[model samples]
Target: MKVMTVFGTRPEAIKMAPVVKALEASPHIQAQTVVTGQHREMLDQVLTLFEIQPDHDLNIMKEGQTLSDITRSALQGLESALERFQPDLVLAQGDTTTAFVAGLAAFYAKIPVGHVEAGLRTNNIYEPFPEEMNRRMLSTLTNLHFPPTAESRENLLREGHRSEDIFITGNTVCDALQTMVANLPPGRPPELSHLPPNCRILLVETHRRENLGEPMQEICRALRRLVKDFTSVEIVFSVHKNPRVREVVFPALEGHERVTLLEPVDYPVLIRLMRE
Candidate 1:
């Protein structure tokens, strides 16, 4: 059987890497990969790290891209890829716009969709904006639901999906982590150079679209207060490329001695930071 895997963005790529590898290793299945350039630079790095050469790349990212922009572009691009591949099953991972578009395209083509990392919900629709909605909608279109935990499987069951269709596959991020860890070089990566040997460290990575403006300010404020109170503690914030995020993050945390702000580091660097 031919299976097409669709994903975009760094997080989605990272989580799907192991799945792609597993699919390639399977003797009975032929796997194809399609990428929508939802996140250009970051997405490329993950693809390079995983050594995945996509069969199709829909260069859909645009400056100041709205959710509608990404959704529409991906839908159109995936329609063509779906027609070309004509796969028996379409697989999408996580809750990105590309994933939703992939499932939608597969539905239109009368092909079954296997949703990886399916059935995850925050319940609050706006906490993560379209992502929660994206996954929920994908669940409706999913023929095979690969939920990470029994809790997520229960979420599918409660939503009236068949128990047999919902499989507890666990999180693929853990699988990707194990692959990265096996290849890890010794010692701290250069990205964590600001660390003092004896200092307590906090590594932060947050860029949810819903957490912009006041919520972002509140988080910055809390971090400021944290560093002020704890003399030996330091904060390393892996900042996002969004101008809105930078506008708030830089001013509030940049000049502070205890806080060190850096651009998004590679997954290997992140794994080490999390380890240390």
Candidate 2:
């Protein structure tokens, strides 16, 4: 069996790495990888850490690309790659535009699509903006749904997906987390070494589209309050690269001594930070 896996973002790379490894190890499966490059540097960081080199890279990232740009680029790039590779099945993970478009392209080509972490629904599709809708649409295009929980499997069944096509597989993020934690080096990360030994660390990651303006300001204000009220509590915020998120976050929290705003770390570093 030939399997081609497509992914682009940091989260998708982390989640799909284990599946790609498993496919490569299988005696009957030939595994191939394609990267859409929706998140260039961040995506590459995860791929490097996992030692995954893609067979094809679409290199679709641009300075101010819109959602439509990403979807259109991925669809075109993947269609050509799929035509060349012609795998028995195409696989995509999570709810990024890359994943959704990859599945859509495969469906158009009459190739079966296997979706990992499928059947996740907020019902309010607009709540998570495109992510919720992306997953829902992929659920319709997918031939095999690898849901992370029984609840997710039930969600698929409730949506009228055949039980035979749905499989309850555990989340790949947890699998990646466990592997990274086990291999983590001793002691605190060098970046956090400036703080006192007894100081407690609070890691924060906020980049939801819904939290863009006023909500983001409120979150920053809350963090500022927390640092002010507690001397021993230090915050390590891995800020998103989006200018909109940075605009509100930096001004609200930057000058504070206890709050350290940083560029996003790679997957293993993130896992190590969480473990510590």
State the lDDT of candidate 1 residue by residue for 46-87, as single tens digits: 999999999999989999889999999999999999899899
Q: lDDT score, residue 198, model 1?
A: 89
Model 2: colliding residue pairs: none
Q: Which stretches of model 1 miss by more than 4 angstroms? A: none
In angstroms, how far off is 91's CA in candidate 2?
0.7
lDDT per residue as tens, model 2, 1-276? 989999999889999988988888899998899999998999999898888989999999998999999999999999999999999999999999999999999999999999999998889989798999999999999999999999999999999999999999999988888778888998888778887888889999999899999999999888988988998999999999999999998888887879888888887778777765
After superposing all C-alphas onto the true structure, candidate 2 shows an RMSD in angstroms of 1.0
Q: Alpha-carbon error at 55 in model 2, in Å? A: 0.7
Report how far off residue 12 is in candidate 2 (Å): 0.2
